[model samples]
Target: MSWTTPSDVVALLRKRWDAGAYLGRPWEPVAVPLRGPRPGELADRFGEAQDWVRRWEQVDLVRLERVRTGGRVIGTNEIPRRVWIDTFEGLCALLRVGPAARRFEHLLELTGRRFPALTGWVTAHPMKTLEAADDWERLLAVVRWIETCPPGLYLRQVDVPGVDTKFVERHRGILTELLELRVDPVDGVPRTDFAGRFRFRRKPDYVRFRMLDGSRIGGFGELTVRAEEFLAPPARRIFVLENEVTYLALPETPGAAAILGGGYGVGVLERMDWPAEVELVYWGDIDTHGFAILDRFRRRFPHVRSVLMDQDTLLAHRVHWMTEPKPTRQPLGALTAEESALYRDLISDVYGPAVRLEQERVRFSAVRRALGP
Candidate 1:
């Protein structure tokens, strides 16, 4: 017969006890006198004695067996008798008592990995509920905060609740230092220090010259001019030289200065604050990149003028003409009417793309003549 009701459960418990089936301790059966109808009645019929049913342990069904010793049962002779079939419904009823019933939902939600730690905390503080534990509150707070903010803004500014400006100030320095160390994936350099001070400073070889009034003047120290310095009044008469060697060789005028345009430092020129009445002039290769730089410069500073960057100069040095790999095809911006027409004819293939006249290729005498006698 299928084991049902309290009586059957008692019988099964007794059989298991007799068979020495229990693995823990010397099994002992304690007689619990039934004061009312069996626990099963209240559990199945009225639910009035549900707590008694949940707390009921079938001691009689799983009684301890005594091994024979002489004529009496010895202290070491006890063992469990046999297996007691525990139904799932009975197990569920047993677990619904006190704290276990209260924490049933939480138990169901815990994973195999998390259950042990949670159970340990519950065991250590039996008076407190699992939800009242420190770990639980911290975990909940973190989860709620994360739901509001994602991880991508780890170093970004955030306004967290209960976090004050003082707290931000405390960690701001450390956070900034960490960000400074992170290199750009594209260029593999600390992004914070990228595009830093491109210009270098060096003392120039002093050379004094007599002024137009025959008065002796002292030469100034070589100042490696940057875009900011180039914008100053002393550098108002801006002279751009394409060749570095020629730039170094040029004599400085009292108020005028030269820039070693470094090919593309022309772009840097766009950022400088030039003087309102400054006379700006560019001297580049009589070729495409040079003209393109001139074009770019004029676009930024429309008042800028080209010096000795002409077809006549290119033709005069025809013997020194060299081929350029990539010639400028796009029309320059803010070009003077004369420069626009001249540049068109030069790149039109009427002259040929191979035609190149670098400024450095021109003789010093030719440059002096172009500048002025």
Candidate 2:
């Protein structure tokens, strides 16, 4: 009959409730205009219209405004024109979301009572509050513990009764938001780095290298040490390669050490105090990003040299060349003329689109020759 039904009114309120509109604030009486049958339909389909009216009349949780209308079947009749839900309780009852709404209200109450500053956060993130409702108590306890504890403790050292590192890790996203409301954010720490943002001790960066002079640090020839604790080995030559296999397979040189380079993470080298006159050489895939990493590394160690990354090496291994999935095309200021030209050719697809020649793909004999006797 083109008239609004009781279900229609409930559906509209349900959408508003799910959107978190009515949960954050007290409900005010909201009157929704009802769509009624046209005058012609009121007379033509009197019985169906009456049944529709009967549905609205049966609904007791809402008030219905009526208008006098006349038709051939009746001299005058009161027809519903609008439905008004006068209370939050009435709206929840009509929408059947009472339990979930009550839970959110409890969360609001607890958050307001304990952490008044986070009350707005609860209102803005009602759904998030509900999702974390089961863990809200423990989450609050963790925040309280962090508030009283000294800074610089690791996540494992967060000594809440039931909260563990895994729990904090799992809830770091929400915790970061809540903690920011209470704690002062540390400078130079990105918000995404939850530990750093909250002043927690972060895991240390490690550098892995092997002493090729057959010398061992204590016992192990290859060792991974904290970047800040790494002491430069007494070697005249340092060979850095992105491929771990290539770094490991390097034949013993008289006074050379091999470092497993972590792509663009060559900045770790800056943590070490390199000795004077030690030649630093990097060998990476003959691709744009490889040259980019070499460029970034050379920015710090301007005297660093690159091996097996020239046009000769790339052309010699044409059979092993593959397409770079995502090639970097940015200009590299630290590259030599030859390296710059080769980098240009790679980005411009001189040989083929996005060409790449991995260091491991080069013949070991060729790598050995590059290393020199």
Candidate 3:
């Protein structure tokens, strides 16, 4: 005779078993419910199913015996003992299924086999912590954003609800640390005395020079001077150059001096004190970035003017123009009407985004011509 399938017997036994446990004695076996379809109905439905039904009854008896003896019969030993459920009723309760329902044995076993892995996954990627749930949610949100958005696109689009610009600005450092993104710091001019002697002990690439004070001078190669140097006392006319080479090579301007305005170093420009009579002229590339820097500088010093940065200059040096990977969005802050129009056309790629007339690209004679005798 062919062996009967267990599913049929299991179904019959489930119909016969009492769902609820006896009060104060849940381990004890209770009589099966007789009101449901009897064993004959199951036998008729499942062909040649007698042995399967018998085996199910025997297994149920053994399970009850194990529960009564307080022997481990369900779940893994590695799981916490406090959460272990012994009886079928207890197992069902833990699984959030009906109590003592024998048909669900297969489901219970399946869950038992798969639960540890599920728990492990949750633990590895926990969305909640003791401190707060919001942090976890925020982290998840960032992950989702990155997954959905293209690279660098998220940086330009800012629309986080309930998060104000000031809040973002205040937590800018923390956000950068978490997301591993860089944001430029607010700009201000460096103090001349401090700029003259300041040197970053940790970062060898950064050096401070006192632009205002003429006392100390070091860093023979390309250097980054603070804004204070240009704005502080002895506030001579300031000549800002985008190229380090051009800045270093600047000939003496008698009473005028030069500064290396590191691209996007406008954050440093806003903090310096300018002399009432001192004039500031920014000379950067004829590219989007150069004009952007010029615009930013003028915003800080409205009287500041652009030098060697015009369409004519760009056209004349078309042969030397290099490509700029990322262009600006137009003159940023308070640019003059003409400067604004020029910046819009440049940034819009009317002359192509890659078009860049670098300051260093300009001939020394052109620089002299722009500076004038």
Candidate 4:
């Protein structure tokens, strides 16, 4: 009963097409073995077997191979043993993907004419090429612009006919693939970084800070500046607080300032050059991740110290304790002995299961005391 049906043949052809096998290699006659009724099946259901053979006779797209079966009930009759699609056109016609196949061929022509180097990509991703058939020309235009345009320009500055920043953003994945084939990647730029790989000017990272000493820079109490342009304020102590509210609510301390640390994004701070004599202090949640952030910050600024991330601070605020959800167990190389001990306890669940005490929950008086005269 499980004989190869017409729909099964079509599915097999489509599977090959979907795999890009048909597009990549030279067209050859494809022969699919047909599962005909066995001798027992022929003897038991001779009329039903005859009807199945008649079904294949109706389908003209494939050339059928008929083999005689020696049977007992019915005289030996021919049944379709194999179905052969003699040409690629016949295969496409049977699959009813003729229009899509023609569009893919057109894409091949266009890619060969304009970007000959990307011919392999066209063949390898025939379906993808067909999917983008409407916007194929515009996608190529973006690539052409990228090739000839001056370096260091933002993606927004890419001027091409019928192509905007949104189009580029939408098609960035495909563009990255195509561009990688044509453009030499920038040194030190990871392949996953779309902007860096193509040398486009990326969005600037901004660092936000508040002057705790009442000292005004451009007469502003709080300021956000591009990381590259960030210059240290006139302060002997810099308190990097993970919570924005804590950074904002800090009592004014003479010759001290606070920066809103961006958790793991503290890597951006490495771009700025801080004064050597300035004391850098970090205050974050008394959790494994908080210690991890401090450890990362200390990697760039070795002299950095942590405040209010101690065992005593965590124990005092037991009422504010919450589950960390996911605790980092990685050994913090830069943590001081006390910080490391606390980090170990948090990871080991010594206090409680994934215990965490957010910096914002700490008493204001304790925060004031931490910033002692």
> Who wins the lDDT comparison?
2
Candidate 2 whole-model C-alpha lDDT, 0 to 1? 0.87
Cα lDDT, all candidates: 0.50, 0.87, 0.49, 0.86
**What lDDT tens digits, residue by residue, belong to model 3 across residues 37-143?**
12343335333333433454454322321111112332221111111124556434433345324323332343235332222322222221212223434433443
TM-score (all chains, Cα) for each model: 0.42, 0.81, 0.44, 0.87
Give the residue spans of candidate 2 off by over 4 A.
1-12, 31-60, 65-82, 215-220, 272-277, 322-333, 336-355
In model 1, where do residues sit more than 4 Å from their true spots? Answer: 1-219, 225-236, 251-254
Best by TM-score: 4
Candidates 1 and 3, the one with greater TM-score: 3
Expressed as tens digits, the lDDT of each residue in 1-373 for candidate 4 is 7988888888888898887777755888999999989888988887888889999999978999989885666778889999999998898888888888888888899999999999999888877887788999999888888988878989889888788889988888889889888888798888678787888999999889888878899899889999888887788898888887888899999888888886876878866667346899888898889998999888888999888988899899999999997888888899999999988888889988999999999999999999866
Sequence-dependent TM-score of model 2: 0.81
Better of 2 and 3 by TM-score: 2
Better of 3 and 4 by TM-score: 4
RMSD of each: 23.9, 3.8, 18.4, 2.9
Write down the TM-score for model 1: 0.42
- Residue-level lDDT tens digits of model 1 in 1-373: 1213456445554464334233112334333233333334333443434333333443332322222212122222212223333432332243223344335335324412443434443333332333333234333333234335533443223455544435434433332332233322224434342122111122222212112121232354444433443434344466777787777666535456666677866766566564336887788887777788888887777788887777778778888988888887886867777777767777875577657888778888776665541
Candidate 2 lDDT tens digits, 50-108: 99889889998999999988766656878999988898888878888789999998999
**Model 1 error, position 161 (Å):** 35
- Clash total of candidate 3: 17
